[model samples]
Target: MLYQLRNAGFTLVELIIVIVLLSIMSIATFSYLGFGAQIFSDVVGRDQLISQSRFAVERLTRELRNSLPGSARVINNNRCLELLPIHASSSYLELPQPGQTNADFVAVPPDNYSQGVNYEGTYLFVYANSEQRIYNSTTQRKVISGVTEQDSTLIFDYNTTPTLFPLQSPAQRYFISTGPVSWCLEATGEIAGQQQLVRITGYPLANSPDLAHGDAQRAVMASDLYNNIEGGQLPFFTIAATLQRANLVEIDLRFARRQGAEPFIIHHEVHIPNVP
Candidate 1:
């Protein structure tokens, strides 16, 4: 009997079926990996947002806590908070008024100043209870010309014209300041038409809050800010001090990791002592 020779090879139908199965499996595998990658990206974005928001909030809180009483003012359409930072604070021994013979010297406890405390370019403030008193009134604010160390006291002398303080602190507290500090949420070009929170300093003290300056130093505190100011949602609000309460600063910051994404929001309140 003669046996016919048969070729041993995969048929066309079997090859096509195998190829289809392989394609389906590949698609499934890639889909799973893509889903995992998306999850990781979302998590990273959320963590980044939290970290940025926390730092900005904490810094603002600490600075506001140390600021002079009644010095906090919201300017620039409620987008900026301006205040004078206190470098040193203590009870004053003497403040020369206009009628007093010694119109140049202010005495304070010697221990308040450290060995490195520089008096140059600093200011002295007394009984600054309102924004007007802190910013506009010259009688309540004086620039320090020199500082002297005595046996048991520290004296700050003013070289400018001597004038009497309009009001005196009942607690006799005196506050020392270097200059004004401002925190503002403004637009920037770094992120393509996005707004960011910035801390500005090294600018001259102005009677009105200066909104823009070329020489001032600005540092970004937080990025991706999405606060809506025109819709009645403001980032900063000041609750004036009442007889029964202290001054309150309300901070509301809204951020987003990407454009068109839901915002991550933070609400904080800082209570400032009304001891001025």
Candidate 2:
């Protein structure tokens, strides 16, 4: 009687093939996503390591540069560096007599040196016959009004001969300059039991290396301060004497995410202008 309409559907074989292809594609997509996630994790970790380490190194550099002439010391045995950071500076326009605030000194700080040390206040030991500090808590500036002794500047005591200032007694040793200062670095358990570069800062006795270690003012400047470093390579800092004092500083910093991760090494030889 009539040409009946017939519905056409996918055959069983074709349906099976389509399912197999879809399964394969899904598996591939998931695999790709997982791989991408791992890559992202590694990238993030490395970046984080870099940022933390770089900050520490920059801080160290700043402190080293800001250190009073010839105050940076690297204790080889402890793998630590010590420095007396300058609070502020003004040129010694003319040696001012006692009780003179308006002397010819017009705060001639070095390049990038802060101007606050003189007026703003610091724990600076004025060079009278003996070191003296006139500190005003409110102003946070050392008042040098009554201090006698023409050379009230902090720079004093040069190591005329070879000296080995060890970490055990940093304050007792003769520093390049005698004033408030402290030390740190290559310390263990500073960051997650991992070796880290630390910055130790504080006001210690002028010539008492023994009392120099007050407390670790700053810690973990750069965690993982090592990256397979070895041989003529200082993993952190080294202070070598030129002439009679520690004038040349060599810093070797190695950054890495993990034990076997790629290393980022930064090495610098800094010759301090202030070091006498």
The regions of model 1 sitting more than 4 angstroms off are 1-7, 110-112, 189-193
Give the per-residue lDDT digits (tens) of candidate 2, residues 1-276.
899899989999999999999999999999999999999999998888878866766776777676665456555344666666665444333333345554432222334443232322233222211111111121111223322223333321212111211111112111122244433445464444246765555554333344335552554566665533334445545454455554567777766666535878777676665322
In order, what lDDT does every prediction score? 0.82, 0.48
Candidate 1: 10-residue stretch with minimal lDDT: 102-111
Error of 2 at 273 (Å): 0.6
Q: What tens digits encode model 1's per-residue C-alpha lDDT throughout 122-207?
A: 88888887788778877788888778877667777765444567566888888888899999999776665468999999777777
What TM-score would every model get versus the actual structure? Answer: 0.90, 0.56
- Candidate 2 wrongly placed segments (more than 4 Å): 1-21, 76-78, 90-183, 187-193, 206-215, 227-232, 236-246
